[model samples]
Every structure is written in structure tokens, then in C-alpha cells.
Target: MRYISTRGDAPALGFEDVLLTGLATDGGLYVPESLPHFSIEEIRSWRGLSYSELAFNVMHPFVDDAIPADDFRAMLEETYKEFAHQAVAPLVQLDTNEWVMELFRGPTLAFKDFALQLLGRLLDYVLEKRKQHVVIMGATSGDTGSAAIEGCRRCEHVDIFILHPHERVSEVQRRQMTTVLGDNIHNIAVRGNFDDCQRMVKESFGDQSFLGGKTQLAAVNSINWARIMAQIVYYFHASLALGGPDRSLAFSVPTGNFGDIFAGYLAKKMGLPISQLVIATNRNDILHRFMSGNRYEQHQLEHTLSPSMDIMVSSNFERLLFDLHGRDGALVKDLLERAQQGPVSIEDYRWRHARKLFDSDAVDDKLTCDTIREVFERNEYLLDPHTAIGVRAARNCRRDPAVPMVTLGTAHPAKFPDAIAESGLSIKPELPVHMADLFEREERCSVLENDLSAVQSFIADHWKHA
Candidate 1:
């Protein structure tokens, strides 16, 4: 399938190009020119397939012979083979009608690995065919860094660099990225918040003069359409597990970047029988405000116990805005550009239409902890802070009691022990067997200033080609 930029200025591109090109030349994100929709029979036929098989069926349309079919299947098989769980992404029931889809069973113990593990393999296949090498510049609030590093570190043609907020992410989050040592992998701790690191990555992508024209740049962020593509698989997986296609289901996603929930939206568009979509956020709740009240305005970023959702700007929201404005790229560009400076307004009809598509809630730190404690006491299920927010948001915003509500369990609780402790739980969440010695591992990471030019200079200086 071919992809077009949201801004409508960049040339339409095939899948391979979109996979490698992070941001469009016109400073917009790539989306499918036309999405594939399946009939009820088509979706039902996929019931008994393996996760890899199901993912191939759901995602193959997007790839569209960009990679040979057998090769693509092999890549997908290898992608999920290393996951800690046999089912890959599994479902755990909390209430009779409420469930949590555990998504942290992958190598990095986060939802990101659902996409990144396959991303690394995809890069290897394409870059090897083209005989090319590229640099990966990604910004993470917490989980994306380690998942990206784990995914790309093994690709010889990739030099991956991830930047995260200094001392803002939990100790486990930091160690997950810093402990993975390789010549091709570098981690930077920015002396600012998650938004600062994200802005620097965007600005660098806009102007790559710092690379001195030696190597091209790529993205591992949700801005890349491939990342969004990989995430869409689990939504379908969860629905099928809950007897979908015949019965409609609901999803509550804990998202800061908007990529995860945006995938759920796309799933609905692709003919999944979804009754409702919930936008679950923490105190940094631009998306929650927009969905609940039609106020698409930014507020000062807050540092929260759920550090991953501590973001002010939701990047993937622009993709939804593209549709809300009826794919008028010029209109989207105008609205988002104005949004960068101040609050921007959407048309009355568009705002009302969006309300039909979503329900939302913004949970604070206290409620997050209470929800964690409550769920543990009620069902003996220990939730990470992020997932706690999802569960809370799901229950608060649910419209129907009969429909199955699936909360996207975004991370392993072990990764956020501090947040668990704050919930007044007496038991400590232990790391998975693979990461048992995570604390004892020696970490290698550079602490960098948040200045854009300084960060760009470091990438140029240390790039393998340099």
C-alpha cells in the first residue's frame, strides 16, 4: 500500500520508503493512502491463527509486497519468537466483563516491543537489500528507549541513539536503556523533560546538516508509520480473543504519544467490531481534555508517578486531526502550526463528530495509586502505574456494562516498583528472570544539555560514519 503525508505536500510513497522515512519532507506524518477493510467472514477466518500468523494477516496489506511474502513471514516469526509468553500478547480477566491484555511479555517488557522487535528485523532485511546504513534518533518518555535499543542493536546497518529525560524516568527505566551495551547503541539523558527530548528529535529530523551529509536519518518513534502498523496488530488480537467480529468490544489505552490508542481507532476503521474507544491519560492530559471536552489545548507538562505519560504534546493526535478536518492537509497544517504557539480551534461539527468516536478521563497520581491498590485487593492483579490509569479510565468512561472492556496493559509492573510501593503495597514487584540482575549491571549513558544544536553536534560527532 502507498502512503501520503498528512500535510499533503510530500510525494506519495510506497511502503519501503515510508518505513525508512520517519517524517515526511513536508514536515508531516505518513498515513496510508487508502486503508484496507475486511469483511466479517475475512476477519472471522483468522480466529485460529498464531499471533505471528495473525499479525501477518493484519499487516501484510500495508507492506503489500514491499518485502517478499515468505521473507516477511520469517521476519514476523523471528520477531515474536523471543517473547516471554507463549501467547505473545495475552489476556487476563479482572471482572466478569473487564479484562487486561498484558503487552509487556516482549524482550524489553513494554508494549513497544510488539512493534520494535519486528522493526529491527524489517530494517535488517531492507537495508541489507539496499546495502545502506542509517542512524536512528528517537526520544522516549520511559519504555521506547529500551525497546528501540533492544530492537535495533542487532542490526549491523543501524546506529541507534535514544534520548530520555534525565532523572525523570524511573531507575528501572533508565537502567533498561543504559545497561544494553553495544558500539551501535548509545543512550543520552537530556537535562530536561520528555517534551524537550522529543522536540530535539523533531528539529534534527527537519534539518540533518549535523550529520554532514554522510548518513541518512530514521525514526523509531511512533511518528514512523511502521511503529503504528505494528501496534495495530495487538488490538485485533485482543478483540479476537474476546470473541470479536460477532460481538463488539471496547478498548482503554494508556497513551501519552497517542500512537497506541490511535492504532485502536484504526482497528475500528478496518472493520473490527469495536463499541467504544477510551483515551486514557495521566496528569499530562492534552488528549483527555480534547476527547472529554473538545478543548485541544496544551498545559504545562507535569512530572507524574506514571512518568511515561508525563507529556504535554501528543504527536500522533495530528493524524486523527487530519481525518477530523476531512484530510485537508492545508487545514491540518494550519491548525497544528497554530497549536505550537497557542490553543487552536476546530470547527463545531468536527469537534462534535470526534466526541462520538471517543470517551476519556484524566487520572491524577493519587487516583492512579488508589486504583493500583484497589485492583490488587479486589482481583489480586498488580498493575503498573500506567496500566492502573488505563483500568481507572476504562471503568469511569465505560458506556455499557455488557460489552467486554479490554484495558491495554502497557508495561510490566516490575519496571515501576517505586509507583507500586507508593500504592502502600507491602510486597515488592520483582523483575522478570531475564532482568533479575538489572540493578547490578553497569550502565553506560551520556548526560547531555537540552540544547538542540548541542545534541545534534553529538550525533554528528559520534555517528559511525563520522
Candidate 2:
């Protein structure tokens, strides 16, 4: 399988190149030229496979000929072995037809670990083969920073730098990135919002001449195809666990960057029996507004209890628009260019096509807190602010009651104690055993202004790999 950029200008690339190339030269995200499909018999044959086994089956087609099957299998096995749960992404029933897929069982206690853990390994394998070193730059709202650090800290050929909005992320979220001590890991607290940090990362990817024209730049963000490829596995795992293929399943994803739910879109493309995909957002509801009401407009970014979903710009939405526009890159390019100036609307048919499969709702901080308290009261289940939005959306926008609704538990409740406490519950969630001493750990990070040149200089100055 080969990957093509959404803009349709970049040359078609194999999986290895797509893994290393974060953003296309034309400022587009990479998607497979064609998705692999599984027949009903093939889907049914995967009933009892373990998560790793199922992941290998789901993703192997994309990784075609990039690595030997045995080596790739071993890499996947070693990657997921670090997760805290045996069912790597397990399901917890909240109601008879409602369930939560617990995705924080990995090293960083967030859904990002599901993809970044494997991405780090994949990068190491490919870089080792090519005898090359690259700088991995990413912007995180909360979870991706720590998860990327944890995943790539062990990689010798990678110098990983993650920037997060200063004073914007939760304490646990901040500590998770700053606490990890590694020679190759660098964290920067930028004086801006998540969108600012994300814009800087994207700008840097567009122009890497700051690396002295030798060192290559990579990405661990959802922009990278590898991250999206790794994420698609869990959708299959979750759907099959709920008796998919025989019966359609519905997924409610706590979306921020749009990567997680886009994986669900790809799963539906690859023949998963998905009835609908729900887009759950906090106050930064650009995606929700677009999907729900066909108003693709950006508003002022809000600092919410769910810091991860506090994004005004949804990056991966372009990939869906690419397909919705029938793969017309020029149209997507025009639409995005128009969007930058102000709110832009797609053609009537395009809007209607997207609405068929996607339903969305925007949950503010008050509603988020209320949902958390309600879920705790009803099921005695604790939910993080992000997952609480997903649960609320799942209930409010579900298309059918008979179909099993799986809301992605994006992060552990302990990660957002302030939000949980604000729900009027006195209970304080504790860190898991592995992160028991998270508060006690010393942090190392640089406080930088949200300027592109300054951040680029820091990467150029401190790049040990270079």
C-alpha cells in the first residue's frame, strides 16, 4: 500500500517514507491511496485474536513490505506489552447498550499511547534500517506530549521535542511531559494556546531549513500517517469485542485534533460494521459545529476543564474533506484557504454527505462537570472531563438504541482532578501504581515565547542528534 497526500501534489510514498514524513511538502496530510477491505468471512475470522494479533491484521496491509512480518509482529508485541491492561484497549459497560472503551492503560495514561507507542517503535525500526537520525517535533494539548516522550525516549536515532501551551494544561498533564528524564527528550512550555503551538509545529514542518539543511524533521502528532495507522487498530478491536460485522457498532470519540475519530472514519471505510461516528468536543467546538450544523467556523479558543479538546482548529478534518470532495485536492486547498480568512461552508452535497455518518455535540465546562457527576451517580464510574463529553454526546446523539455505543475513555480520571472535584464530589483520584510518585518527580523544561523563530532556534541549538 502506498500513501498519497490530501493535496494530491506530493509524490505517492510507501509506509516507511510516510512514517518519517510528518506533513506533505504541499502542506497536506497523508492518506492511503486506497484502503484495504476485509470481507465478512475475513472479518469473522478475526474473532478471537488478541489486541496485538488483531492490530497486526488490521495494520499489516498498510505496513506492506515496509518491515518483515516476523520483525513487525515482534515490534507490535513489545510495544503493547508496556500497557497496564491485558485487554490493551478494554471495554467497560456503563449501560445495557452503552460502554466505555478504556484507552488509558498505557504508559502515559491516555489514548495517544495506543498510537505513539507503536509509532516510536516503527520509527526506530525504519531509521535503524536506513542508518539515519531525525528530529521529531510535536505540539500537544496534554496527553500526546507525555505519550510521545514515553514512547520515543528509548529511541537512539530520535531526538523528540514536544511543546505544550504554558499554564493551559492540567497539572498531571504538565507533569507527565516534564517529569520524564531522558537525554533525547525535550519539553517546552510555550506562552500561547494549543492552536498556537500546533501552528508552530505545522509551520516548522513546512520549512525545516532551520535544521541546517541536513537533519530531517519528523512528526509524532496525528498529522503523521503512522499515528493514524496505529490508531485504526483499536477501532477494530473495540468493534469486534462488541460482536461487530454480525451487528453494527457505534463509536463516540472524545475528539480534539480529529485524528481519533478520523480513525473511526477509516475503519468504516475498511468495512467495519459501524452504524455511526460521533464527534465529541468541549468548548472549542469547531469540529462539532461543522459536523452538526455545517458551520465550519473558528471561534476564540477557550481554556476549559478538558484541556485536550480545547482546540479551535481541527487539523485532521481536511482528510475527511478530501474524501467528501471526491478527492479533488484543488477544492480542498481552496476550501482551507478560504477557511483561514473566515468561516467557510462546503457545497450542499458535501455537507449532507458528511452529516450522514457523523453526528456531533459541543459540551461546555458546566455540562462536562454535570455529565461526570451524573455518570458517577448512575454507574459509579469515574470519567475524565474529555470522556465525560464523549458519554454525553453518545447519549444525546445516538442514532439507534439497539446498536452498542462505545465511548472512548480517552484519559484516566486522575489526570484531571480539578474537573472531577468541581463536579461536587470530594473524591480525589489517585495516580496509577506506575505514576504513583508523579508529583514528587523533578521537571525539566524551557519556557519559550510563542514565536516560530525562537522555537526553531531552540530545536536547532539543542538537537543532540544533529
TM-score, every prediction? 0.99, 0.99
RMSD of 1: 0.7
The TM-score that candidate 2 achieves is 0.99
Instruction: Output candidate 2 Cα RMSD.
Output: 0.8
Report, for all candidates in order, the number of backbone clashes: 0, 0
lDDT at residue 429 of model 2 (Cα atoms): 95
lDDT by residue (236-315, candidate 2, tens digit) is 89878888888999999999889999999999899998889999998889998888778889899999999999888889
Worst 10 residues of 2 by lDDT: 288-297
lDDT of 1 by residue, 301-393 (tens): 999999999998888998999999998899999998898788767887998888786899999999999999999999889999999999999
